[model samples]
Target: MSESITVAGVSVDTRHWIGGRRVASAGTFTDHSPIDGSAVGEIARGGPDEAEAAVGAARDAFPGWAATPRAERARILHAVADGVEKRTEELAIVETTDNGALLRSHRRGVMPRVAHNFRFFADWLLRLDHEDFETRGHTNHVSWDPAGPCVLITPWNAPLMLATWKVAPALAAGNTVVLKPAEWSPLTASLLADIAAEAGLPAGVLNVVQGYGSEIGDALTSHPDVRRISFTGSVPTARRIAASAAANLTPLSLELGGKSPLLVFADADLDLAVDLAVEQYDNAGQVCLAATRLLVEEPVVEEFTRRFTEKASALRQGDPRDEGTDIGPTIHPRQLEKIDGFVQRALAAGARAVIGGHRKDGQYYAPTLLTDVAQDSEIVQEEVFGPVLTLQTFTGEDEAVRLADDTRFGLAATVATGDRERAERVTARLVAGTVWVNCFFVRDLQAPFGGSRQSGVGREGGTWSFDFYCDLKNTVTAPEGWDQDHG
Candidate 1:
């Protein structure tokens, strides 16, 4: 093992995990802290060769892993979860340092959820009982089997947490995996590989490949041995991955970007509605499901904007390591620039910035709220993926639903109303995979999570994940002359 090196107040290992061992890449790249321009650490950059090796390793391990007893698999996954819980603080620090997310949120929310995801999948899989259905003179046997060597490519926004969302279920379903962590945020992923090893995962079962998406992502997706691909990222990148996976006709489950809408009706509880709107600024609004487009009923538009903007403007922004900081700098300078560009374009298009409308040094963009933004404007239609909220008003429920579903992206949505019937009806009309009523971003481990239309193609979490990672196989046996009778 390479000696751990401290970078940007956290320790990181730059080596890539391949074939159950820490391997050095042929090239190296420097990681910069989004908190400042300082260097975070050096990371080994892997390419097509590394992707091939990782896939080969996974393919080599598949038979043994798949054949391993389900109880044993559950045990290892539980151990993995324990490992994560034990190192929660360290992992949270690494995540915040690498991804520029608030350390408080990482510790309180992301880390615990990461651990929960592993444990949930571990226990859930152990409880899944395969059954054989009886029929007249025939027995139909059904079972879930590993999808063979699989590739998981995670996004940078919530590195370790999202990594587990895919990794735990894939491993639990008995598939060997090659995980390609986003180049922008690889620290926690490298740490995760170590945690899995400590939990006694078999050699060549899970591999972590590090490098830019441009360098190794395509190779991993298109590798011949890879039977399935699970990716969480932007729509454009998802499209690219979808196309590459087509070479082998690989099965894919994508949880892509979102331009989620948060609708606040006149009948809604004002305090709760404002709270949900303010929550959008979390993680500097980089969350895929953050309420980027906020629609308010015309009667309550002014009051809602007042409360929401006040809360948004008061958000504390500083170093993620600071406990009191509510917002942190974006992941990189490029992301910061993109966010600034979105706000600027909105302003030029006649949108009025009610709170923040500017940027600072070292990848810091303020939590901004804008109004009078045209429904078809760039900021409203596109996923800003930043701390910029655009407000619009609807005269009635029908217009509100229409305005909410106006976008091509339908990943997640929210509706707040005191009337339960109205809430249910409005949520149903909104075309999103996950719709929140009187709440925002409250995820259930067992509930399906993903998007629709351009937002994404499939779901993750709980059974949806198991279904994605495992292929269902059915067998039928005919007794005596049953086949003749059936024919």
Candidate 2:
């Protein structure tokens, strides 16, 4: 590995991990922490050359990794999960330093989910049934043949946890990967490479190249050998990636931005709805699956707003490393500016800021809530991606469904209701990939997780992930007696 240094008491490698070794780039860039504009570390500035090298390494590793026994792959994945669990706090601190998310959340939820990603996918892969049914006296079997080298382009918001969401299944399905992590939070990805290596993952099985998207991202996505591609980012960036990947007709799984809704009915428990609304401020509302658009029924709208604003107003915005900090800075000052623009525009359009309406100190945007927002306002339609929420009221269930499905995004959503029939009726009409009845971000690894429409192009999680990472095939054979007689 490259020279190691300490940041937040965690040792992180600042060079590219290509071919299972530290590879220096011709240039370098310094990652500045958003918390206080501190220089976090010097990261490699990878370009087309580095992207090609990493892809080549993954390409070379694919055949052997695919041919290896399934059990060995699962074993190695479990070991990596163990490594992640052991270093949970260390990883959490590094992630907080790099991305400005709450260290407590990373430790309590994100890192454990990372470990769970690997373990769940590992065991799930081993349990896939490969055999067949007798039809017309003929046996038909299936196989999830490993695709060739793959490219995983992930976003910066949640860093390692999101990267592993793609990496775990890609590796477990036996495809070597070249992961290009978002430059803003690239540190933990290098650390993840170390974890996989220490867990006995074969060389060239997973590679990380860090650089600006303009420099190396297109090259990585458009490479000839990259058989499958998965990207999680903004729609504009996804468009650019789609254009580049179109040259080779590479299949893509795009999980883009969301302005997902959280619906609260009149009969819903007011405290529960308020708590879930406050939870959106988690990660400073950087979550792609966050229910940023809250649609509350008119009967309880006033009470709901009172409780939500009080709770949201009380959220502590401070150093992410502090266990009690409920909200942290946006990833960068530019992001803070973007978030502020949304709040300003909404206020100018006569919307009321019931809670926070400005940036806190350096990079932290206040946990702002917008009320009296028009259904078609730009703030309602656009994704602010900060500690912000928009509240709207509907008179009836039909209007609630209409308002919820009105966004261009359909990533994920939340529903707070007391009636089972109402929950079922509403969820069926809502166009999100995942919906929670009364909770927020409760993920089942085995469930199909993805978005619809502009939110994303395809799904991941469970067999959906395997279907993308592997080339599924079905083979049919003649009856055993007939084949033997012919032979």
User: Which candidate comes out best when scored by lDDT?
Assistant: 2
TM-scores, all models, native as reference: 0.96, 0.97
Error of 2 at 341 (Å): 0.8
- Where does candidate 1 stray beyond 4 Å? 1-4, 8-10, 479-487
* TM-score of model number 1: 0.96
For candidate 1, write residues 1-487 as lDDT tens digits.
Answer: 2435675456777888999998887788888878886777778889998988899999999999999999999999999999999999899888887889988888898999999988999998987666778789688987788889999999999998898899999999999999998888989888888999999999999999899888899899888789989999988899899999998999999988888888888999999999999998888888998878889999988888878767777788999999988899998888888999999988998989999899976789978889888888888998888889888898989999999999999998999999998887888788999898998878888899888999888887777788888898888888775455664
Model 2: colliding residue pairs: none
Candidate 2: where is the Cα deviation over 4 Å?
A: 480-487
The window of 10 residues in a row where model 2 has the poorest summed lDDT is 478-487
Distance (Å) between predicted and true CA of 460, model 2?
0.9
